[model samples]
Target: MNSVQSLIQPQVLAQIGFAGIVALTLTGALIAVFPRNILYNILGLIVCLTGVAGIFVYLGSPFIALMELLIYVGAICISIIFAIMLSRPLHLSLPKRALPKVGLALGVGAAVFIMLSAIISRTEWQPAAMRSSDWSIATLGAYLLTRYNLVFEVISLVLLVAILGAIIIAGYARRSPS
Candidate 1:
């Protein structure tokens, strides 16, 4: 339709898209941090991560974006969901929120926010004169394996241990009475 075309100019559309992505990211972050439900928090985190991936695409690195999607949204969230399923009933009663605890948390959050805002506002930001804009997955993998091999290995071992511990816990739970 002419109306649709009129509203969707390419350059303006790109800026609108960026704004929408930023809105999505902020909305997700707020939902993740402020919600009472654990599942809602996880879903919000996924949304935030998806928005971050879109931002990475805007920044010219789709590989990192894909990894962000695969690792955080796919693997981590799925594993967390499985863990929740294995450990607790869907109808488990949530603990009542204590007012004093919530007030303390809010005070801490406010303090951190003010401190960070001041730091960020005062700090200077400048782009490097020469920066490599490589977005290749192969290059990223090579760098991780070569330069950050120890970190990669440690993370792998940690994941392995976590998976094994989950299995053991599940096995024990299965043998016990429901």
Candidate 2:
């Protein structure tokens, strides 16, 4: 037990955890992007978002991590899955990918990557000026409720409308046999 404990120190464990999180994020992103199946893509997105939440937690922001999980994974991904499942039959064969379009996408992606890399390398990163340290959950909730309540309500309404639309479409799809 002592030997095992010595071999797996806190610093080593932390490094391993960080590496695992990064690997998860990358793998999930690849899965999301490269898969042809919509269901698989959604699952990959969930994995990627979960990995991002893990990274936020690792960076010492548990609130942001929880919000990421709750909003992206729980609400958005689930809603997407529900819509996809109800809208169409999963067994239908997807059309083959066009080579020219794939090539174009790769070229565009590479260009964007190079541009972002150049911009990031040339930019001087600076820490923000330290403000009041009252970043408690209660304080954040109060601020959101008081100042950003309209934005919050608007977003909620949008989501509600989207969900309702999805339900209506699903119902219509079911009734009209293709």
Candidate 3:
């Protein structure tokens, strides 16, 4: 019983959970980028977003986590999947990767990674001076409906427009023979 208790310690469990979440995020990112299949890429993106939501929960922001899951994974990804399904046949082969473009992308990704690493290492991250006590879901909803309503509506409109544009473009592509 003592050994079992030691194995089940909170800190140990937390560390394991964090490691698993990080692995999930990395795996999803790799799947998203490396896959040639569009469906696989979307699935990977959903996995990555889910991992991010898990991270948010681990960081004590359940509201943001739930929003991530709902907005990104639930709404956006599903819409993308629908667009893909409506647009093209799953068995159609995509164009082969260009080596030069791949190299350029790698270079850019490395540069951005290095730049972000330097900035993160240099910056002094501090807590807010005045922490708000009213961080409940109800309060956040009220604020979104009241103060940030315009921004919220704008974002929704943008997403809708983007989705519509994708559908139109896909339809056009389908109509035009390669």
Candidate 4:
């Protein structure tokens, strides 16, 4: 087959896959934020995060994709669900939306989106003078330990505190009548 035909074949398939992911992400975010059902919102957030993890995979960071699945999908979502269970029954309906604030929020979101798009289109992104040829997991791990050691340690400490705080909060809430 000709180069043009080969390019078109793969490009079309890639575009289709990208569109599917975009749809999944948007749909999940809509369901998460707009739904009155908390359980549905949590499920939608999980779907959205999964789509994001897939995007990370496509961006050539399988490590980040796995970390996203481990931290967000495994830990964060489960913790949120536990907090939801502790705080409120699934049967309870959320309060009605305030139409004025909803309109304001939509307007702000649209403005921000337009501004960001304009800025991105106008900017020229330049690579470093000497780009590294290595994109290996070993290099990433070394960077995490050496160059980014402080950030890595801080994040671990933060996660540890979050878990301890969640446990304390749940304990306190349990002791008090709601």
Candidate 5:
């Protein structure tokens, strides 16, 4: 066998990785959105986000992958957990939803999925004419502080506001009669 044939096949590995990601994404979505329990949903969201970070890593952007892990898994998920704990008592069971409402939600979600799939199937993605083969952490750091400084600032601001709001709301809920 040739040297190339003896080596691990990139395409096969890529396909397996893609399959794993897709499975994780679907499983997470089901657990997050379908479950009535808020805690399960949050945990599922974390799983989905982690899988997405893995996908980003596969796309040759380890910096983004790390950021994904940090921002989503570290910050957002922890905040959400804190919110859940502060707002709702674990002993209290949530009330069941009406069947009609559940059916309506399912219908809407299915329609959206079909529409999105069709759009994705029809779209033709094109690469830049002069695409550079430079995928570096230094370049990403420079761009984050330079080109995407506003976005970074906005995200930080948003996170700060969310934390403040969560604290206020939870405090109010605790004081007020529900």
Candidate 6:
């Protein structure tokens, strides 16, 4: 009963959610990269950004997660979609994959993987002698309220200005004689 209860706990649920988010992110990234269609790529990018917001939540920053969703998906992706709509359409006939290019890509990937593995295996990781334990949620909250408050406010102001600028530019483009 206790084991079952533990499995249904918030921590376990969060772990499952994290795994799902990671899967979602990877799927979106694959879709974004593999598809030739511009619209599909943009949609995939939105999905991927949403998944990344989930990841930010998993990493213990819901504020960052919300900001990520708002900035990337809400602002950037929407702007991109609007731009796509306004721009001249590229005739997107699918091209056949070349065998030599595929082979060369695979070869390079394998070489990079092997090199990374060798470097990682050869390296000895040692913790810093004076590593600080100042990464607690309490410390984070305190810092946000105190030390980083001005920085946060400045960033928020900048983002607001940027968003307004983007909107104005977009609107101006619409109003201008094409």
Candidate 2 lDDT, 52-94, residue by residue in tens: 9999989877899999999999999997887777657762557
lDDT of 5 at 92: 55
On residues 77-134, what C-alpha lDDT tens digit does candidate 4 reach at each position? Answer: 9988987886676538677899999999999999999999999999998889998788
Task: Return the top candidate by TM-score.
Answer: 4
Native RMSD of candidate 3 (Å): 3.1
Instruction: Write one digit per residue (lDDT tens) for candidate 6, span 1-178.
Output: 9988987899898888888999999888878767778788888998998999999988767888989999899989997887877765642555677889989998998999999999999999888989786656788789988999999889999989988998888666568676
Most lDDT-accurate candidate = 3
Q: How many residue pairs clash (N, CA or C atoms closer than 3 angstroms) in each of the candidate models, in the order given?
A: 0, 0, 0, 0, 0, 0
Any runs in candidate 1 off by more than 4 Å, and if so which? 1-7, 168-178
- Where in model 5 is the C-alpha error above 4 Å? 1-8, 88-91, 163-174
| Candidate 3 ranges beyond 4 A from true positions | 1-4, 156-178
Q: Candidate 4 — which residues are off by over 4 angstroms?
A: 1-9, 172-174
Model 1, CA-based lDDT: 0.85
- TM-score of candidate 6 relative to the true fold: 0.61
Worst ten-residue run, lDDT, model 2? 86-95
Descending-TM-score candidate ranking: 4, 3, 2, 5, 1, 6
Clashing pairs in 4: none
Q: What Cα-based lDDT does every candidate model obtain?
A: 0.85, 0.86, 0.88, 0.85, 0.85, 0.85
TM-score of 4: 0.84
Output the lDDT of residue 170, model 3.
65
Tens digit per residue, CA lDDT, model 3, 31-144: 989888887899999999999999999988898999999999999999889877765675356768999999999999999999999999999999999987776889889988
Pairs of residues at least 3 apart in sequence or in different chains that clash in candidate 3: none
TM-score of 2: 0.80
